[model samples]
Target: MDLATIWVTFTSWAGAYSWQVIVTLAIVGLYFLIDRLTIPVLSRSADNARLTESSGDRAVGLARLLTGTLCALAMMVVWGVQFGSVLVFAGTALTLLGVALFASWSILSNITAYFVILLHPTFRRGTFIRVLDADNYAEGYIADLGLFNLKLITENREAIVYPNNLLLGRPCVINPRDRLRGVGKLPPLPPLDVVPNNE
Candidate 1:
């Protein structure tokens, strides 16, 4: 088509969807502003709470994901996408995701627990803790709090990788200060005596 024809087509298209374009831009701009305003505040809160850098980063990432998802949904609505269709698509997607995640349910639980730990100042790195499991009790200094598991350096110089989900379920006694001075030196285990029966 000629330049004049192209100009006419463009103008018609723009005229038809001008409101949608404006609304989309506004939503995007609002998301950006929220991101800019909240990120620094989240970082500072994490720092003040003595949370790990990874925790702060994860929180920021979750926030960004939420903002982006909301903005996209808003834009889709503004562009006249039917809500029923959107709901059906979202439901199907979520169902598939749920099934996929079911096998690795612990991983999902751990991620959720990670956020909980990040928000609550309970189990941070460098704290001494005892997990109250009668059969499999563990006491150690927390070396690092990871998304899936926490690294615990036992008093006996043994490192235990404890799952975040398990950590949340079990009762724990926390010593805010490192008792071993950041060393993993444990008391000696009691000697086991073996007796043999001769027939």
Candidate 2:
């Protein structure tokens, strides 16, 4: 057809899908906006934990994955994908969620605790920490903060791998004024005092 015929047909098609185009653009803009606002914060957190500034990419990646999923779902609705198509996978998703809840609960908890540790102002890498336990004590410097577990290096250079959640559950004493924090020559930790349990 001539240019005039093409222009008329295109206008008609655009008029029919105008709402979808507007909603899709809005959804995409919102997705990028959320990522732009959140990624810098998460990236700073990751950067602090890792000295090289590379781990921050993981934060960016995770934010992209989650926001992409949310925006994709919104776009699907705007385009009027049938509910039957969505419901088809709901059963499999529910089954997998159930298994994760029961089987990988501890793993999930540790991952969550990693975020808590990053946010906790009092505890951090290089903080001289002593965990008071009933059986024994764990005394070391907060050598490395990680996603699932923390790596502690004692004054004697012994490594203690502790799960994230259990580390948060215990009472910890942090001595920021410790002169030998990085030298691996920490002074003797004070004896633990037993608090009487009322229960």
| lDDT for each candidate structure | 0.74, 0.70
Residue-level error in angstroms, candidate 2, position 84: 4.9
lDDT of 1 at 69: 82
lDDT of 1 by residue, 51-146 (tens): 668878977998788678868877877887997898787788767656643434547667666656666776666778877564456778777766
Residue pairs in candidate 2 whose N, alpha carbon or C atoms collide under 3 angstroms = none
Least well predicted 10-residue stretch by lDDT in candidate 2: 177-186
lDDT of 1: 0.74
Model 1 stretches astray by more than 4 angstroms: 1-12, 49-52, 81-83, 94-106, 176-199
Residue-by-residue lDDT tens digits, candidate 2, 1-199: 9999999999998899999999999999999899889888776666565422433454467558868976887788778888667556555765664564334345656665766676566665677787756545677877776667778888888888878777887787787443343332335669999999998
Worst 10 residues of 1 by lDDT: 176-185
Error of 2 at 37 (Å): 1.1
- Return the TM-score for candidate 2, rounded to 2 decimals: 0.67
- lDDT score at residue 123, model 1, on the 0-100 scale: 63
